[model samples]
Structure formats: C-alpha cells, structure tokens
Target: MNTIKVFIVRENDGSYSSYMDEQANLPYGLVGEGATVAEAMDEWNRAYNDMKNLFEEEGKEFVEAQFSFAYDVPSFLLYYAGKLTFAGLSKLTGISAAQLSQYANGYRNPSPKTTQKIQNALHAFGNELSQLQLV
Candidate 1:
C-alpha cells in the first residue's frame, strides 16, 4: 500500500481541514474539511477517488494509486487523546500527564521532538498489541 502524508489542521471554528502534501501528486488546492479529523480524512478520500475516476474516464493515468494516510500531531491527538487517559499516555510517552492533558486540550502545543516521541511510543505500543495471541 502506498503511503501518503496528509496534514490535518484544526480550523478556528473547531472543525478540521486536511490536504495531501505536494509530494503526493494530488491536485493542487484540493482540501477536505469536516467536524473531526476522521471525517475530514473521509472527505479527502472521497475527493481523491472522484478525481481518480474522472481522470480514468478521460483515459488519463492518475499516478497516485492507493494510499495509507499519515496524520499530523494535533489531528492524531484530537481524535485519540480522549480514548486513553492522560496518565496512561504519560506512562507510555514519558511525558507528564499534566503536559499531555495540556496538549490534548489545546492549551499547549508539543514541540516537534515531543511529537515525534509520542508518535514513536504510540507506534511501538501498537506493534506490541499486534503481537498479542489468545490463550
């Protein structure tokens, strides 16, 4: 599966907007917006498929094939931060729960390094979970 980087941003009105980076070769100025990051991502997928189909109908090759998305930090946290307690996330990320809570609530933004750390920890946890087997 091809991986595409999608940068999702929260709008001032509390909705979310997303777009593919230039490297993805998607059309310029195409944006997807919705009430949540997931919804915005769904909108983006619909738009991408629509464009792909339109290009195909015109006998054009859409260079961008299937894609797996990579979401930005705020979008990722916004969607999932609520699912785990701040203490739980802190235990996994080595960040203080208060700081994690601040980041989750939009009271603070994590530095790039902190974001990377969090992402790496989450990926590691997911990998561990994937290794689970029923007794």
Candidate 2:
C-alpha cells in the first residue's frame, strides 16, 4: 500500500502552509496570515478535486483493481480515487469548468503545468488499481 505524506509549515503571518508531497505535485495551501488550518484544508480539497477532473477530461481509463491492458484500469485511475466533481475541480484547480468539461469529453487537453499540478494532487494515492496483484 502506498501511503500519502503531508507536511505543515508556519508562515510569518501566523497562518500555515500545507505541502502535499504525495503523488500530487502541487502544494495544498498557505495557512499563513489570515488563513486557518481549516482554510488550508479547504484549499487542499479544492485543489485535489480539480486535478481529479483533469484526469477525467483527458480520456484516461481507471481501474478499480489490479488490472492489465486486458482487464484494464481506466486511464483516469487517480480521478476515480480522488472522487472529484468537475465543478469542484474547476473551483479548486483554477481551470474553467467548461474547459475541464471539454477535456473530459475529449474536445481538448490540459497544458504541461496543469498536468504537473494534477499529478501532484494525486501523488499520495497515485497508483490505485495497479497495486492489485492479479495484474
């Protein structure tokens, strides 16, 4: 099992910052100054959701268990694991929901930075179904 790791940093403003080094590449939130841990957590959820939507938009497949190309995991494995809604993802990832919808529907694609950020958000639970033994 892959366990996700996270760290907290205190800011000069007396708020906090959360760095999620798991599969997700981008950090979760800055708790410094006026932000509370709750706020940071809210940010984390929002960011994570957006990345999940990114995967969905990309036409990726997701596998719920150990699967082979024959059995197959959905290319969007992380998306499933993350349990994100498209609107939610947009709110968190800062990408327009419409754009994300286009990506998921296969009308468009996300940029490199977007891809990296999405991966960062999924880093903790990166490989979901692949970890299964049957594949």
| Top TM-score model | 1
Off by over 4 Å in 1: 1-3, 25-29, 56-61
Find the number of clashing residue pairs for candidate 1: 0
Scored by lDDT, model 1 comes in at 0.78
What is residue 49's positional error in candidate 1, in angstroms?
1.9
lDDT tens readout by residue for model 2, 1-135: 223444444454645455544453332221212265556556655655665566578865422111011101122422232477667666556667677666654566677787666565555334654575772
Note the clash tally of each candidate: 0, 26
In angstroms, the error of model 1 at 117 is 1.0
lDDT of 1 by residue, 1-135 (tens): 446777887766879888777887544335788998778878988887788788899988676655556666655666776687778988999999888878766789899999999999999999999999989
Q: Alpha carbon lDDT of residue 32, candidate 1?
A: 82
Residue 64 of model 1 has an lDDT of 69
Model 2, runs deviating above 4 Å? 22-34, 61-135
